[model samples]
Target: MNKDFNSIVKVWEAAVRKSAGPKKRANRIFSTPMSVAHVDDDVYQVEKILNNGDFYTGQWLNNFPNGHGKYLWTDGCMYVGEWQKGNITGKGRFSWPSGATYEGDFKNGFMDGKGTYIGSNGDTYKGFWVMDMKNGQGTQSYPNGDFYDGDWKKGLQNGHGRYQWKNGNHYIGQFRNGLFNGNGTLMWQNGNRYDGCWEDGFPKGNGTFRWCDGSFYVGVWSKDSKEQSGTYYPSSGSDDDPLEWDPMDLFSVDLIDCYVCGCEKVSIFPSQKNLNMFGLEEDNNNKHLLSKKVTER
Candidate 1:
């Protein structure tokens, strides 16, 4: 966002220089006609048509545009708003050739305060701007049915925000550089939710996953969310009873006895054959949805 808006500023600066151009560069820029040229100390303001085909019709003070004005560039870019000295300031609307527009408050020629930016691609951003970048709080909506509402920094998602995927998945958490970081909650539409810490976009460290069917796992998840070393308590056994695990395993308990399925230690991999054992095949391959599709299960 910063790089693209700067191009418009460059052209505007050049045009301002041409307003007072010298004869040394007469080929591209010619002298302003006396009728509309800057008249120093004159209280009256009039429209000016420069030789380069640019147009400015507004209030001028001394020799610079200062107050309300309309500036039209030959390249099809246009600005209609307030002006201070020679810079675009106060309230205004800047439109690009592609139909993209920015309407808001400006200070020192940069988009500041609050504004709304509508892109040519149907993306709309309404929020706080600093130096032409989306900063502070804002809401960015896409044409793809996805939406993000929360904190923004330097045109990217930073701090905390809520992102809703077009596919019915949503995450509420802290973010750094657009990826999930710190503590957060990711809830799948299928009724499975994970509350934990995430690094980058993957879940990591200690967390808990609760399935739609009421089965749950509490343990430390690998960075990839592929495997979890914890206790899997069956829905029927809400008490202290847990499915028997390998005695040598670190998560094993000393005297906990298995009673239900006679199921011994369960070693879960991402294969459908292993996941179908407990009717978890509907959410297979997702890995993280259940660990990554067992810990990638």
Candidate 2:
């Protein structure tokens, strides 16, 4: 009978211990709330007060903003957007007190992917960016009404593009290092146009220049000057007939006073009218109009 009573006591003690253990655990859990600090009186939201005095208010994971949040720097700079592990990693807008701002994709707090940046001086850029520099295809607009749209590399104009100036001048062609370096066309405000090869922003090779007066020149150029051989086409209905003359050609001449311009270098083939008036006749092929020792009063 005593052995049976000791066995009963052991069963009762086991039951009591089981009941008390769960009750103590329940009390402890209820008394001590979750360790996560609420952001603004809401237990669901979390905030991280940075050591550098920068304030962040948003969802938090392990004391760092992990979800969408806004961070305000101590120097009046602010960024409001998605964050991953305390780094700006997604779409966000960062602004400065100096009126400079950037709004676009961010990778590790650096401007990456498509974005737009507006400078403090009213300059603006919109397009692909890499490491905060203009790269790939993009468009830049200056405050003075100048605009550029084309390929860029390392912040310099490269590849094909179009640049328009505020003075109604424009260029469309291949570019390298921010200068016209290949075939392109330039139009001026005065109705003049140049279409041809370019180097260092000037016509350098074979090309055509059309003037506002309807005259045109087609030939080769060197350092922006017509060189060697070129053809000049005058305007329609012009009284001046087609003349083939080489400016570099040498001619034989005697010292005589020109009745016209009084210049030492006189035109070789004066018109037939001038020849008749001067009483000069062609000796052979009529190539030389001025006779030997002939003077005009």
Candidate 3:
């Protein structure tokens, strides 16, 4: 951080705040900087340094950085791109000392419009931004092979989007505050799928689960599908009419983490009726659905 620059900014801000009335408050967090640089009479292309050891080299107007210019800060941050009226604006590339880089549209020093950000941890996001935050459509790729393609708001995963975990588990649904909080479909790599509503990163509300072996269940669920409550229909014959009209009490089977930071695995136990109907030997994957008792992974 540049202390000199910050002090100057603070002094300038104080002046603005005292000017504005109480009703019209000036957000100190967001600032509109005003400064004048002192240069020689010959104000041609030249390199000028500020009091804070920040330097700008390129087209300058009236002692301020204007038009195309490159600015380098004392903290090892450098920006090379367009400048307007002493502010970092327009298209440019900003690089930080932490190995993070942003290349795209900028507005008054804030990342706004289309751009791509490469984080220090190798995470990359390409999308639209508003006031330095990720907004609108974008695609984010994680170093661990996790990927997200969807809508974003205030730098969080919001609205509709698709998240693909590194374990081959993918979810497509609506999100709120970076979690699976709305309707979506989670498809496990093992061919297990759940289509329903989600809340706070877990499965909740009414939904349908389809197993790989043709078994399925329809019911309301809460949190993860640990012990789900609903009706289970084992895959005996047709999808329409179940060969056995028996409803088994579904209990703890698998723990599908929907696992943001962890992994999800769900297993269904064979009901006594399913065992008798299809015979355990014949139907290897014979399990059914409903009532849930969520447990930690």
Candidate 4:
């Protein structure tokens, strides 16, 4: 009983109007004649009684629209769906005057469960909803040919998903509050690829940058820029010595030499050829000397 009945009515009225069409057109209520007949205890049927000479003939309970009903509001707003104690519930389809439409499951007068919402601006979202907000897995497509398909929480991309732009740039990975965060992979239309950890939509921490020319860099990054020195591997090396490889390169290996250690032959142990490849001569088990520039290419 602490809930304000007047406020609740106003909110419900607003929800209907907003979902129908332009807010300015629905600001005022239109008068109409209506009749009500009692069916049983606290149950009745209303006819010809709605805003703006609209029609509503349906079952009512507790003096409110309940059970199955059809309500055509003023300003061409129409809703045909199930109701529970005056609130839209279950399956329904609501159409606005501007050609916007929503068809899906509802609960407590709010869009919940699976549904599709097509906006007048040519944007569309088809996914799980909660309280009229995108809340779960869904796909949103923009008018500009860009689209996002992934997990959502409270209308924001808050989990793993993929977004592709019209220009051919795309990102796939974890997200937090609609921004790229944690691990992800981004690919440019020009054939550049970045695989690494991200923070605030920029590549950060350890990552790899593979250029279109076959040269690649593996190392730490700060705000998407290479920090300090990193290991560079040329696609075509003429050096007779074995090339140095990053530990992460083995992650994409399809075969491994050892079952117990899961280490591939190229990464498990470095040979004397490997030491000479990096211009390094081992001084001890943990250190070495740089004999020359290993990456002259």
Candidate 5:
């Protein structure tokens, strides 16, 4: 074995002896391949044994907690797996003194990884973690039967995801700092659906909102209110009308004007009696009518 390994083993042996006490010496001899160093400091396994005989185990390097290990405090809190200089690191499991249990990645003794935590109240969280909190993608279930599945950050629902309440209310979309922000869609149990941008949990920005009663609005939204907008056109006939119309029909009026104006004026009237016949009418009606008329020589 390497010198370092041998030295670590010796230290581990001494720690075991110290913790086990003289009475338990004859029970068994504990062994490990870990070493201790008193140069920069003392490397030793630290343990706290309760009066009831429950034991907590961990490591101390250079008189401080270091490396990968665990500690079960006398208070009933138990931490197992991974350590760095006495701080939790890497993947591990932790059971709170209150009966809650967490299993996942760890960093500096905090939960950080792809893991799960079951709360004492029966709620549960399963997903990515950061510093003992839920962050990134995951799922959370409430004890009261509510649940959320979506992106998370620093233990809050942030970014995009879906929230389903026990009352059958649901919101799916962008979130910020746990509140509805950006764009989202809300579906209420009453059969109404609101699709639009949100700010501070209120509808804000442009969108199309529809109610279960066949009413809807498509326009700019401002803080849950509809501004100037267009009709919803709820019926299927309104939806299909535009598609049924021929594309060429839009130019029909213009086509008629162009054709008629290009034709000869005489051909348009077709009767000389109708043309300049106005002159003869003025002559017959007396010069008073003629005085009102300008001679078009």
Candidate 6:
């Protein structure tokens, strides 16, 4: 068995030597060296040879995958699209050995364009890709039927988006690092709902929280705690007196002591007269008093 294996290896080496000249052999065996444009303008011909991974031939300006054309790694990863010098340029598609595929624009071999990525695990993402990850506006669907549609950054849920769970729970709002943050609305399967600001996946700031039992609170909140400010009226409260009132009337004042001496001598004043009964001098003050007779009854 060892002899047969050695024989096969020898034949393989001989075939490679015959197909590639000195420079080409040096390029494939020692290091990557070739440019597709230098060899031929036919992209299909270049792809055919490169796809085999036996011998790679291209414009050897700077050696390796630096040039305009298709490039395929021996590990079953392949790139088909534009190339500059040796790095991937313009639009392209990369298919990995693991069955993952990315089709979009490329910058130096990194995915950086509007494209779609289908993962080996059955997850799929369609949108803008940056540096080989999901970024910017996009949509992601999981194998379990969960999905998110919105803005993404570095593979995490960020900015405005909508998340739908398999069990019918849904959230529409802002997100940071896959957690609910900023302003948003959550609707549960049991009729409970929350519409307000969120922090680290918890309710915070000013907003309304509604329960399944028809109870609700509309007020300022701090990490889910209600603050001193806010209006929290029971659902069954009467709407006729919507204005809140306090039992203690702060504006009420007590009357001063009477100036009259006798019980029967009740002091009366004209409505139109502006005389200061208490502070007036002589005639004006005594006129009303003198008209009344002192009586015990």
lDDT of each: 0.60, 0.58, 0.62, 0.61, 0.54, 0.53
Backbone collision tally, model 1: 15
- lDDT tens per residue, model 3, 3-54: 3864654454344334422221111111112122334563334444543334
Q: What is the C-alpha lDDT profile of model 5 across 70-174, one tens digit per residue?
A: 543333455677666435667778765445777878765456779987877777889998765578999888777777888988778888988887777788899
In model 2, what is the error at residue 3, expressed in angstroms? 69
Could you list the CA RMSD of all candidates, in the order they appear? 23.7, 37.7, 24.3, 27.7, 41.0, 40.0
Give the local distance difference test score of model 4. 0.61
How do these models rank on lDDT, best leading? Answer: 3, 4, 1, 2, 5, 6
**In candidate 1, how many Å is residue 144 off?**
0.5
Model 6, 1-297: lDDT tens digits are 133644654454445534432121112212122212224442212212322344332333332343444444444444566656545667767665556777777775567879877777767889997776668999887777678899988767889999877666688999988777899988777776778887766666777766566656666655323342455444454454323222111101100110101111101111111111111111354332111121111
Model 1, residue 259: displacement in angstroms? Answer: 42
Off by over 4 Å in 4: 1-45, 51-55, 224-229, 237-297
For each candidate in turn, the TM-score is 0.66, 0.63, 0.66, 0.63, 0.56, 0.57
| Candidate 4 lDDT by residue in tens digits, 76-150 | 566778877656778888766566778899876667899988877777889999877789899988777778899
Total backbone clashes of model 2?
0
Higher-TM-score candidate among 2 and 5?
2
* Regions of model 2 farther than 4 Å from truth: 1-45, 48-51, 224-229, 241-297
Per-residue lDDT, model 4, residue 154, is: 80
Q: Model 4 TM-score? A: 0.63
Candidate 4, run of 10 with poorest lDDT = 267-276
lDDT of 1: 0.60
Q: Write the residue-wise lDDT of candidate 1 on 1-297 in tens digits.
A: 234534765666456544532222122222333223334555334454546555566666654567787776555556788887657779998876566788998876677889988777777889998877789999887767677888888777889999876777788989877777889888777787778887776657777777678877777766333455666666654665665322123212210221001111112111111110001111334321110111211
